[model samples]
Target: MKIDAAVCSSARLARDRRFDGRFFTAVKTTGIFCRPICPARPPLERNVTYFATAAEAANAGFRPCLRCRPDSAPGSPAWGLVSTTVQRALKLMRGEREPQSVERLAERLGVSSRYLRRLFAEHLGVSPLAVWQTERALFAFRLLRDTHLPIADIAYESGFNSLRRFNGVFKQIYQRTPSEVRREGHSSRVDVRAATPVRLYLDYRPPLDWQPLLAFLGARALTGVEQVEGEVYSRSFAVDTGDLVRYRGVMRVYNDAERNRLVVEIFGQEGGTGLYLLNQRLRRLFDLDTDIEEIQAILKEDTLLSSQLRENPGLRLPGAWDPFEYALRAILGQQISVAAASTIAGRLVTRYGESFVDDSGTEWFLFPQAEQLAEADFSDLGVTRTRAKTLREFVAATLDGRVNFAEQSLEDWCTQVTSLPGIGDWTAQYIAMRGLSMPDAFPASDLGILQALGSEGEKAKPKEALARAEQWRPWRAYGAILLWQSLKSGEQK
Candidate 1:
């Protein structure tokens, strides 16, 4: 990744929040890398060097700045801007329990290890392993700062094989031992028990349209499985450790707007690794890694979206908690209103979903797993016979390895998914947009989108809508979100 020194210098001096995770400032004199929004006095231009990723800076022998905590910054929005291959690789890497060998990872991505290494080198100025190592070390560091987990537990949870290795990695990256960092953090140690909830924060770039985002989730929230009360969004989650052990819990997230982060409180038996996976899921669920400004710049070119862009400056694409669950919801929602889909979904959950009561005595239901719904009947849940068959087939495909949520090109994934019976362009594109977090995925056939693009109270035909959306290519998903938001705003007025 090429970094324009002059541009970085200006942003560094200005402490621009927009540039926070886009790049990191490595000060040669201090041998430390900091976020662009670091509050420390700006370093002289001569001592400053910019790296497109914190991993690059760490590989360059720079320690993370204690003051700014680069690990806590939003993920680099610039990551996927240039290479989709790199983007896919990253998504895979973040969700892995242990970093796979380059050969294995490349095979999953349909690329040779050599070519994958070259792509990482060209786009991130680092090897894939270096990126993985940095991510692991930083995640452990975050655990140190945010939770009271024992250092040993943090080690295993952060994917370190042993306490010594964890210490060595922390020393190499942060120039401090895990114990030192924890002590410096000054958070009182609390015994982590199965029932005790752990609190953590997930940060994002500013101008987040938080309340509206919550409202969007609240409207589509499945009863018992999800609850959105006031400004808080809470849900029950189940994390399969891939080792035959599954952990269940409830998590609540609310905005900390003043600090530009969300406070996540987890009540579960998951250790570090499970929490790590949950973090990734929540980040995707809220679309926290997006650079809204950069996306808006492209979508604003469309006259249809421009007004909504101004009205909802930091609108985010709300993502699914689980791809399979959301895909089922989309299937249930075919030719139905949002409320109707949600009602059916809630009934499905009540039927097949696992039930648990938290310490507060509040009952919560986990979204039904594929196995649970595979042989189950949905006819009694108010689902039409055709829709019920589609749901069962979708679950069967998921179980038979016909539908994978793994890393793949959006077009390929869409083609593979739409091949199934009853799933069409709109459903596939909708899944791609939210389920797969594919930004360019757009459902041109969507009623709401067509209505929003239509003029004088006439709905645009899907063909016309598709043609008009051509200009929004590579960002059509955000365009879709803008159109939907605009439609909602119109209804309210």
Candidate 2:
């Protein structure tokens, strides 16, 4: 918590939103901690203490201020900080799939458990497990606030092992019974804005160009599974738990105009685990929370991506509707166009995926899981043996726990996928960018990227493309998207 005394003092004086998640001001006199952007009166400098997270502040006995829900604050931009391990860990905790253990996570992080523990303590001001617990409780809190499910069902839906445990923990932290929280919403209506109606608020950063985004998804729309019209993008899937969930949601900018959070209004069964799984996938798919401003500034220096950045700065590489499906499409469309890759993906989903009906429409099965694909032979599927082996290996790894996609660092994930025969840098990176939601990942060796750069204002060599991409910094993945879009446009003209 490197607090510059000057910055803290100024933020308190101005109540700046930019400093919101950087630190919290715990007022010793009033027993309250406030975000720098809190609407309340500021406390004296002598009576203040600073903490990094709401959990850490609460750990010190400061009650939450009602006016400002610290929990609702956008998550820390920690993706730009620390190793990818902590961010990856948070994703798993949301799904409750990967067991949460610091020692076990430490093993995966390639550092001793001791060093990883120290990293969390030093950087996040809390233990690794503490972050996971807070995430689960909050998820449960949101579900309880927004839904009308029975308590027993809500408990399990929020990833609690038992109803009793859920009650005890919710009561312990919120200082009230779960019933109280439910009662508060009973006055008029539950915030039933969208679960059954299939409307959801998806959050994202500002300066988004929605037309291009929708056009990209609309053109590549798959039959019976996905649709994109105007600002609405709806999709259906069967979750890992074999429950059918359909989400026909609308995307909206969050209320706090400065924040990048998209509020997704999900319409589904209150106890359904599938929507939770869908949120995990959608955040990566739309990638609205990404910081493209920083990315474009970096790419402005490079000749190849510079003009493209000017044209389509917010363009995001459309991520996979299904990871396995995306991997197959990537392999099958190796030398083809984006439209071709998308067509292949649609064929694979229609053939191998299932069908379910919801109010939104007929939702098709999610991309078949590893168990279904591992037994599938590609000889008759119109894919090559090498591609078949790569696809099968992906399926096998997921089933055997070698490629548990939910909870591993991007580097670890890429290494695991690349270790399979016939998967190289290109395939590995394509998977990393889409399959794993790795934003910084850049698949630069693509023939299209090479050709775009090579034929551009200043001719760049194929091998030099990687070096040229280095200037894009943490946003090379976005640059890759723009370059690809530029190539397609240039060819059409």
Candidate 3:
């Protein structure tokens, strides 16, 4: 997590958007840490110190800057460069409820608490508990500033056990009580019972090729379950909140390219941790946390990928909204055109998915869960018998816990997934790249990738493509995306 102070100083002085979340500038005089892109006047270099993460800054007794709101910055790139253990730990924490204790988290990770703590300390410069608390506090602070949710509800939603603890942590980190901070930001309070969509904004690093990303989603968008209109992408979601409770809702994401953020509108009966989970999913779906510059630096070294990289500078690896859903989609897509696969997927949703009607009487379909389709018949949905059998077996394996989406290592996960019947390297690699958010997962056998790498209207063999992709190690997923974009731009032979 070491940072170059000179580089940080220059980024801070230039208000560089690319370095927004890579590091934080902690001011000695103000005792506040700001994003590198903060609008506030530059502080003296002597008064500024750089921290690799906001948690590290908070651990050093520096408050988050109200102006820059470091919490809202794209996730620190340092998270991507950490050890596999830390990466898995972070994924688990962000994907679900925080484990009750470091012991519990360590147990789940199959490592001892002492070892897990050491990894966190070495990489993050903070304990696991510190990271968890900082995340919760910062999430609550964002809610206070952006939403009308009551303080108590915000506390519960943000993972705080009680209002007292929430206030204490809020004050400890932000140097102000929750109410005081809310008032200072002048956020209007509203009734908790009101049936209004909760709106929130997520920030990302700049040079986002937003239209291309949207086009990618729209092409494969499942009918009735997802819709893309104009610049907005909307979909229906069903998030399980345990105890047989589920929050079903529709969320629409709008591109705010001018501001370098996406404005998300959530239409649902809001209360509970579902909103928090939804936020994480949306961030992944958009791949907002990736460091485009870093990925480009490596890919641009090759002539083939370099041309595509220059054509689409800020292209991103589009992620899945749900792993199970995307895995099913991948299975459905095997050896078929994208349009044909999407047509069958739409039929599957129409048959097995749940219907949700919003206040406007507009009906939407929620993608079916594993249990919903475990034993269900898909023969009538224009699916081949072989594909149906594969789908059934995949769902059964998922239900029986043989296929875990939360697995840590990409190689191990891919191996386990490919072991399942009819699921090959391509499906597993696609799942890893988009579903699991593994940056290194590359499907060398992908037709589009092979075609993009070929010459004179010829497609390269999988072996040739894999060989050429060796130079893009640890970022082959992004390379795959660039290749796909090249096909769209007619840059490929």
Candidate 4:
């Protein structure tokens, strides 16, 4: 993550949004840190210091800038490319109830606290606890500026245990009282009422191909569970508690093109915990945190893929909202068309999914759980007997804990999944690509990829296609997405 000073300086001077999350700048003279895309006056080169993360700048005793709000900047791409332990830790930190201590966090990652701190220091230039505190502070800063929530509520919502601690931390970081900071820049505040949806911006690197991604999701969206209309992508979800309780809600996310960021509005829940978790889910679902430039650098080296890459530079490999649900959809879609699978999925939901009604008068359903789907009859869902057997086995395995979506490495998950009935290399790889968020999980046997890579009028064998795709190592999934889009775009011509 060591960025060249001259290059960082140039990005800062130009106020480049492209480099927004790649790094942060701290001014020694002003004692303030800002995003690379900050709009305020640029500091002198001698007074400027670059940091790979906001946590690092904060660790160096620099307060966040009031105008730029480094906390709201797009997350660093380093999170995507880091080691598995760090990646898992990052995901866990986003949970509503995070681990109590660095030791606990390390225990979750199966590493000692010392080693965990070493890894964080190496990659993030800050301790894990510092990173967590910085996240809380910044999230609080965003709430203070955007909403009319009570300062006390904002404190607890931002992970502070008490009002005194929240106030002290705010002053320590921003050098101002929370109320004062809010009042200083409260002109654009929204009058947040008790029932209002919590709205926030999730920033990302530019050049997102929103249309193609929407089209892909729209075709496969299950009725009552998910919807994609025009620019908005909305879904109903449920989180099962340990004691047989479940919290249900609906989320809506869409692009604010003028702001160069995605706007996420969470309804049916008002706590910061739900808001934080939903934001993480949406970021993953949209693949917003991917380093497209790094992927494109590898992909463009392939002469065969160069043209497709040029045509859709911003194409992203979409991830799943719920990995289990998506894995079931993948099974249902084994060899069928997307539309056919979606229709059957809708029927399956109607038969077994839990129902809920939103405030907007739209009826919604949560995707069925493994326990419910295991014994359910799929005969009426428009699937063949063999496909039905496959799904039943899949559900049974999931219920029996033979198939786990979490706590398993990507390689192990792929191996275990391929062992199931009706699941093959292609389906397993597809699951890994979307469900497990493996950037390199390329399903070379996919028809779209084979069709896109054929020679003249001859289709390539799966083995040959896989061999040819070796050049796209570590980013073959991105190449697969671009290739798939090429076929879809070609069909419209």
Cα TM-score of candidate 1: 0.96
Model 1: per-residue lDDT, tens digit, 279-352?
88999999999888778888888887899888889889899899988888888888888888899989998888
TM-score of 3: 0.96
354-458: candidate 2 lDDT, tens digit per residue: 655554564554556666676776555566787777667767777887765565556777787788777777877877787666776877777667767775355
- In model 3, which regions exceed 4 Å deviation? 187-195, 488-493
C-alpha RMSD values across all candidates:
2.0, 4.4, 2.0, 2.8
Compared with the true structure, all predictions reach lDDT values of 0.86, 0.63, 0.86, 0.81
With a 3 Å backbone cut-off (N, CA, C), the pairs that clash in candidate 1 are none
Q: Per-residue lDDT tens digits of candidate 3, residues 1-493?
A: 8989999999999998889899999999999999998999999999989999999999999999999898798888899889989988887787764335889889999999999999999999999888988887888888888877778878877877678988998899998999997777653554655736787889898888888888888888898889899899999898875547788888899988898999988887566347677788888999998888889888999987889877788878889999999999988888888888899999999899999789889989998999999878788888789888889888989999998887578889888888987889998898899888789999999988988888998999999988988999889998898888778543310
Clashing pairs in 4: none
Which should have the higher TM-score, number 1 or number 2? 1
Alpha carbon deviation, residue 106, candidate 2 (Å) = 3.7
TM-score of each: 0.96, 0.81, 0.96, 0.92
> Once superposed on the true structure, which residue ranges of model 1 sit more than 4 Å away at CA?
187-196, 270-273, 488-493
For residue 311, model 4's alpha carbon misses the true position, in angstroms, by 2.1
Judged by lDDT against the true structure, how good is candidate 2?
0.63
Q: What's the C-alpha lDDT at position 50 in model 3? A: 94
